[model samples]
Target: MFLSFLYQYRQYLVLGVYVLISVAFMIAKSDRVNVNLKSAAISLISPLQKVVNNVSEASENFWNSIEELKKVKKELVRSREELEKLKGANIEIEELKKENERLKFTLENQKKIEFQTAYAEIIAKDPSNYYSSFIINKGKSQGIKINMPVIAYQGNQKGLVGKIIEVSAGSSKVLPVTGVGSFVGAMMADLRYTGIIKGMGKTSDHVVLEYINKDATINFGDLVVTSGQGGIFPKGIKIGIVLGFQKVKYGLFYKDIKVKPIIDFSQLEDVYVIFKQSEETFYQEGD
Candidate 1:
């Protein structure tokens, strides 16, 4: 009977204890106590909220900085690329200006000559390693024809380029005097020694002067010029300078002399074609 009474009153005892504690808290009625409790609770939770906010703000700031940095890097790369392109264009313009000045000088000087001169720009060059040939902008339509003499110059300093070998509607092919199949009737300006300048199959950037007299006073640095004997090239046009001389071992009549052409073939660009007024008559005869 006693144990049953204890179990039945157990729930009531717990409730009464809670009610007593609430009465005691109300009787205290101290403002300091209430304030202390609220302060403690706020202190604990405020730190947690502050920590969470700080973490979120830091993550947002980090991502924003990354995006901004990427944009800056991209702009910097583009600016550098543009600068390089401008530099290349500037270089090309400078080269073109220099070449134009050279062409103008040549034209001014050629005006004194009686023959008609036509200016043409070099357009293309052969890609073969064994041959030296180039194409010019003038053709048969411009009065250019086969066997026409090509002259290149820089400020009144004229040199032979080659002769027109093939002609088309608007362009012509030039066989340079240094080409393997090219020949020029040349003479030494100092000694008046005449010979045929022949290409040595294209190597070492040199040509051979054949049929030079063994007794000819050919020396290094002697200027060679076109003799105008074949009526192809004009008289007194510079060809090359003598670099060496070698007499044939068994032949006493002739000697071989090596010549270095005045015109730098590797850097050829614009040239002038000498179209004699006689070409019109020659072509009309064939028609």
Candidate 2:
């Protein structure tokens, strides 16, 4: 019976023995016993304290890294935004530069004109017949009128462009010299021979100079100009250069002459309208 009781209370007995040893040490008055007890207590707690410090250090480092990453991300976003702004500014600057170049070209050409003229920009074109007709930005409100001769300055030389046919309050329609219905009294620059220059439809690259005297000396590359014979185009305006001449199809008295216009109609952008002429210049014949 005593052995059975010992077995059941064996765990309790061991715990009581440990408690008694701890109390005995507490009650001891010897200096060496006290020192040994303090040493054992410090040894047991040292590893736990080290573990706690390591945990604290690791957590602090993790949080610090997170803060740095946030700062870096913010800076990256700011940099992207600034780059976009710079791109937009650069684009605007390029556009302004192109506008300035166009203005400079217009101003330089305007200086070469001698008559009372108005500067006008080409506002629109006939898609069906590009070189035949077009529209200008100036209109009757700006003193633009029908039959006002339009001319383009190119390569430091002035060339005949067309004339105003229709005028509105804010815009005017122009019939180019290449239009089928157009005609101008033209003369050769060197020979001083005069003829009527006629447009051979929109598709033709050269105008037809009709009623040339068969006996007149005709040459290729002869410069043609307005003769001021009709009451429309002013005299001395460059028209074209002679390309070739052919015998009239059915007549013996005239030559069918082709003249290449001086102005490149495809590249025309700005032009001057001859609103008024000098007093000394006059038309010799009715338009």
Candidate 3:
């Protein structure tokens, strides 16, 4: 009997259920208690939401810091490259300054000299040999010839350095005044007494002036200059200074004298070779 009664009320039952759902929804929306329950549920989940947001922001900041570090590293590398370039430029500037100094000195001396000359750089030296003889960078290719007079400007003055004994394609060998076979006709600047300046067999700081007569006054600091007798060297070229005089057993007339070459071979860097002398020089020969 109840089943038969439910069959008859099925349509009403469905309509009543729909009405109940609509009424419950409207009541929840209007009531303050239901609104408070919704607020409480949001409060319970807020801490989790805050933690997730903090993690996201931290990740973003970490990536930004890495990018900043990369930019700084690039800047540092560029700075190092610039510093290296500056260092190279500084070295080039210093080299240019030295070259200017050398050319200036050469030009100043060239004005006072009366003969044609060739500027040559001393390239190689035998330091073990007092540098009495060395090689220059200029040679026959540069109009250099054998027996050409080599002069150097040093100590703020021009002085005779050597003679070109050998010439090659691109270089020349200089027989400096202090060599074993070196010989020059020189005279006392004060007394004008001429003598033969002969080099010792072993390279030495001083050469032997054998033709100085015992009568000629010789002093420890007397300047000696070329006499221009042989026509090989120009007159007024500084030969050396007289250190002392000694009596020898062989020649009683001409005593032995020690003279030092004014050209410091060890410090020789640049030289001028006499390509041609403007005038012929002659010195009176003494017995």
Candidate 4:
């Protein structure tokens, strides 16, 4: 019985030693297996990581381009708005300048006339085919009457423009110096040679002075003015300058003269109507 019990104890001891050796071997190999698995995972995932980086960079670039485009559009809109504002300002400035010039002309004319003068602004012009005449914004209600002489004021110099032919409640028609049936008794400022200035029925560019004496000594650029002989126009009002003279061999004792008017009818704007202070006295005196 003693021998059997000792043999059994020896068998138990050998079994315990075998189990401990197996556990130690498993612990030692665990570290090497884990290292190999980590290496394989890194190799497989590297390509996918590179692809993700490329996609992220492309997305960032697309957003940057969109931002730049929006900025350009905004700049274009701002520039267009500024240009429109500048154009409006320029138009307003030009209108103001015109108004100022008209006022200055009216004030200077007030000093020259003996009677009360009414200022009229030209509102419309007839078509060129009908000759160069204009309508003014003054009428009988403003003491304007038919046959009233209209003169343009240039600084202190008064230039003869035309006369009112038709009058309305608030407007009048002006027959420019160049219109048909227009005539004025004019004289040379230097020589005092009297002549009848007749319209060419065309433009204020030229007028014809008939019945001028051949020996009047009239030359180019000589100043001509209303002689105030017909009791129609004021004395010393400028008509035009002499352009040329023609001598007809078979004609009577008169020569033909071409004249350029002082006033540019095409540019008529503001004018003053001269109302004679003493109409009866002027006509009766035959001046």
Clashes of each: 0, 0, 0, 0
* lDDT-better candidate, 2 vs 4: 2
Per-residue lDDT of model 1, residues 169-223, tens digit only = 5666788999988999999998888999987655667888888988887779999
TM-score of candidate 1 to 2 decimals: 0.59
lDDT of 4 by residue, 66-97 (tens): 99789978966875686597864765577699
Which regions in candidate 2 have their CA more than 4 angstroms from the true location?
1-108, 278-287
Quote the lDDT for 39 in model 1. Answer: 37
Q: After superposition, how far is residue 36 of candidate 3 from its true place, in Å?
A: 99
Give Cα-based local distance difference scores for all models.
0.76, 0.79, 0.75, 0.74
> Model 4 reaches what TM-score against the true structure?
0.58
lDDT over C-alpha atoms for residue 135 of model 1: 70
Query: Considering lDDT, where higher is better, how would the candidates rank from best to worst?
Result: 2, 1, 3, 4
User: What alpha-carbon RMSD in Å does predicted model 4 have with respect to the real structure?
Assistant: 44.3
Q: Which candidate comes out best when scored by lDDT? A: 2
lDDT per residue for candidate 2 within 56-98, as digits (tens), equals 7699889988998999899779867876978647655776999
TM value for model 2: 0.60
* Tens-digit lDDT string for candidate 3 (53-119): 4687699889988998999899779867875978647655776999999888868888977788898
